[model samples]
Target: MTERYSRQERFTPIGPGGQAQLANKHVFIVGAGALGCANAEMLTRAGVGKITIIDRDYIEWSNLGRQQLYTENDAASLKTKASAAEQRLRAMNSEIKVQGIAQEFEAETAEALVDGADFLIDGTDNFQTRFVINDVAAKIKVPWVYGGCLKSYGIVLPIVPGTTPCLHCLIDHLPQEGSTCDTVGIIGPAVQMTAAYQSAECLKFLTGHSMTVEMVYADVWGREYSSINISGLLNPECPSCSRDAVFPYLKKEKGLKTAMLCGRNTVQVRPDQLSTLSLSDLSSHLENVTDRMKENAELLMFHVEDVRFVVFKDGRTLIHGTENVEEAKKLYQKYIGA
Candidate 1:
């Protein structure tokens, strides 16, 4: 180990052997928000050989306070989180390979993106996406660290397939609906604390240490912390991680057509069949119908009435100003056409 990782390598538990193991490991991270950014930076500096991060959202002014990899310029330009994070991670550790995928990690693309990863990390904020990650991890027999934060509280769990309880085991206890960062708000320390726990678990796993599967909960502001062994939560009958696992979440459904972004007052609309869209042609076509139109290589931004429209090359349109799927779908059909 060089001077770069000298300190980390000298930390008895992760000495030279662990450092060597980390150099050859590939970690796949989902989401590029607060947790994702923090986790990526830590792993990169720890000399992880390769890391792949996928995220669908773009950076915004509100993200700068906690999402570590983004800058004011990235937010101003509306750069996708994955691409922006990739650029920063590469700069941090040129010796390691970092690939940031700018797309949604749904059932359709989840398995493929996590193909060669040694393990997975959850940086995603929503449960829907986490379920997809859980499904992918269980199907491939890969371990994943789950972390979530809201307000001052956060939770972390490391799920190892066949050995420990998978996410599906705790589905009933997981938050179905509650406060969100946009609503109740979140503290930067909460995000950092959650990400720290998640990163520690990853380090322990990647460094050849036997992982202790546990669900950890903490409230940074309240200064409360607790953990419980979740091994008992493992259900042999779980369709997702059972011995006869069918991986129901990975089954081909028509694909999610519309998703109401939690706490953002935004609705994402995806056509039944995806197609490459020509932004230039679309820009010219919608010039009369839209206002404050902007175009870029990755996506097109415009406004229809009071709503903001962000259209990606893959024909996925994020309709801001409304969380109603029906309303967003109507706008999509009327403006973007069928």
Candidate 2:
């Protein structure tokens, strides 16, 4: 190994053997936003062998404030966050292998994306994606660290398969109502602290070191931190762990048929028709209708009906200024040739 990771390896907890183990481990990070970017950078610097990052959205100007992996140019180019993060991480540690997947995380894609991973990390912004990750982690018996942040507060928990309570055990069912990063606004410090906690647990798990499996709640602004003991919360009647819920999220039994991407202010619609569109081709075509047509290999950004459309090649488009799937679909059809 190079001297780049010498400082991390010198830590007593990791040592030489643990550092070597980490160098051979592979982790899947489910989001490329705040939590995802911070965790990816830390683990990469810590010498984790391989990392697979998955995200559906592209970089935006707003993301540069807290999403550390991206730059102004990346945001201007509308680069996929996962792809941008992978590039930065590789430069940070060339010895580690990094894969960036600019794709949405769903049940059908989870197995293929997460396959052969030693561990998983939750960097998603929505409950739907978190639940899907929980189901996969439970089924595969892979341990994963979960983290969430809002305002100046955040929480972290490590789920070690049958050892600790699963996500559903704590939330039971998805909250009928919730405030997202866009609605409530998230502080950069909260994201950083939460991701750091999650990264610590990930290091502990990979190094075979002991750590509390309880939920860690942190308030960065208040300078307060607490660990909630959830060891007893594992439900004997829990559908996911105890009864084998059959991964409903993957089956589409749960999760929204229509989802509004938080922060991006875009609505995602799930239609039966599976069609592919080249962003470059679409942007060229839309130039006639709007003068704001801009295209990259991964995404296209355009304006229609006072809303900005940041469209990906995989038929996933982020429509800014509205959270209504119907409206987004209407705009997509009208401007992008459907």
Global Cα lDDT for candidate 1: 0.89
Candidate 2 C-alpha error for residue 152, in Å: 0.9
lDDT of 2 by residue, 222-271 (tens): 99989988999987766766655566666744322457777667787543
Cα-based TM-score, every candidate: 0.97, 0.92
How would you encode candidate 1's per-residue C-alpha lDDT over 1-338 as one tens digit per residue?
Answer: 28998898789999989999999999999999889999999999989999999998888887898899999999999999999999999999999999999998888878988999999999998887888898899999899999999999999999998779888877843465756776898889998899999999999999988777778999999999999987888998887888988877776667448877755789999876778999999999997885699888999999887999999998999999997889998998888876
Q: What is the lDDT of residue 247 in candidate 2?
A: 63
Candidate 1 weakest lDDT stretch, 10 residues: 172-181
> CA lDDT, every prediction?
0.89, 0.83
RMSD of each: 1.5, 2.3
